[model samples]
Target: MAEFEAERRMPAEAEQVFAIVGDLDRLSEWMPTPIGVRQTGDGEVHADVDSRDVHADGLVGVRPEQLRLEWGSEDSPDYAGWLQVEHAEPGHSSVVMHLSFLGDQPEARRHGSAAGEVRQWLDDALAQLERVVAGTS
Candidate 1:
């Protein structure tokens, strides 16, 4: 399996970041490319590539100090990962996103490049989120 992980410190509270990531509809706002995601069930989400629907399974784990999401898409050979938030203080938190994909196909390799691009996108999005939440933007 190929893996990619990134972490960032956010000024917002953990709950705030957790809420943003948990809301499937908000993915297009932070993801590198515009993605259409809809809740398929209580904890499952379906993503659309442009307009073609892609299936994915998700699980949410909530704790007193953290929130985590484990997800995997059907199109990927073995793509699976988790996004997590750990509260460090009342107004500060850490966000970690981990993604893994398995395969060696040309298309799979191309899609793998998304790991880096997506990480940068999340960094930008988190910055914007911090500004918006702080009402400085």
Candidate 2:
């Protein structure tokens, strides 16, 4: 299993952050990835690559009180993670994204490997997300 976590301070309320990440469909917007997303009832969303990447369909677990998005995928059989937002203070929030992918496909190995690209992608995504959310408010 490979796990990665990145944290940042966002200039927005935890609620705003939660709402943004909750819309799993906008994933590709902030994260430089080509994700095709479709709503799968409730708040869950099925995301894929080229529509053929069907294994990673799942939901963004949103905990309003905790200000987080515990994300997981149905792909590759064993993948789970989360994005957390903490109320750092009255007008600021701390964000943390933790992801774990279980496999041994070199490209899916530990960080600094092929999987590093995805890790970095998420890092950039979170940064962009912070900017986007701050902009709206």
Candidate 3:
């Protein structure tokens, strides 16, 4: 499997940062990926890649005790990831996001210009998270 991870230190406590991460409805506000995530009345979560592409049904697991959130595609199990929040210091915390590509073409997508794009996307996501944590976004 091919994997990518990004960590960022936030100016708030672990619980504070995790409160934002744990919200399922506000995902697109901070996360650059997975636009238009919505949960149906029957409790099934769905997300669209774009307005024109196919929608993916998914599962989301939230663990408040561990300050972690796990999500993956149920329709296409080739990718899965989790977000973790840890206490860094007094009144400060660090958040880590990880993505794993379990498809056959993982290695190819992890190299060359594709790798750079992925890295930038991860960083950009964290930057947005930072803004949200700081109450600026």
How many clashing pairs per prediction, in order?
A: 0, 1, 0
Per-residue error for 67 in candidate 2, Å, reads: 1.5
Q: Which lDDT tens digits does candidate 3 get at residues 1-137?
A: 67989999998999998898787777777866635777642335787756236488888888999999898888778878889999998888999998887886433277866566556767888888888989932
Against the true structure, what is every candidate's RMSD?
4.1, 2.8, 2.9
Candidate closest to the true structure, highest TM-score: 3
Model 1 lDDT tens row, 20-134: 7777665555654445556666665676644224445444333424487777765554667777888887788887877665765322343445555555655665665555445
Model 3's alpha-carbon lDDT is: 0.78
State TM-scores per candidate.
0.66, 0.78, 0.83
Considering summed lDDT, which 10 consecutive residues are worst modelled in model 1? Answer: 105-114
Which residue pairs overlap in candidate 1's backbone? none
Find the candidate with the highest lDDT and give its number: 3
Runs of candidate 1 with Cα error greater than 4 angstroms are 50-66, 75-77, 105-118, 122-137
From the highest lDDT down, the ranking of the candidates is 3, 2, 1
Candidate models: Cα lDDT each: 0.62, 0.70, 0.78
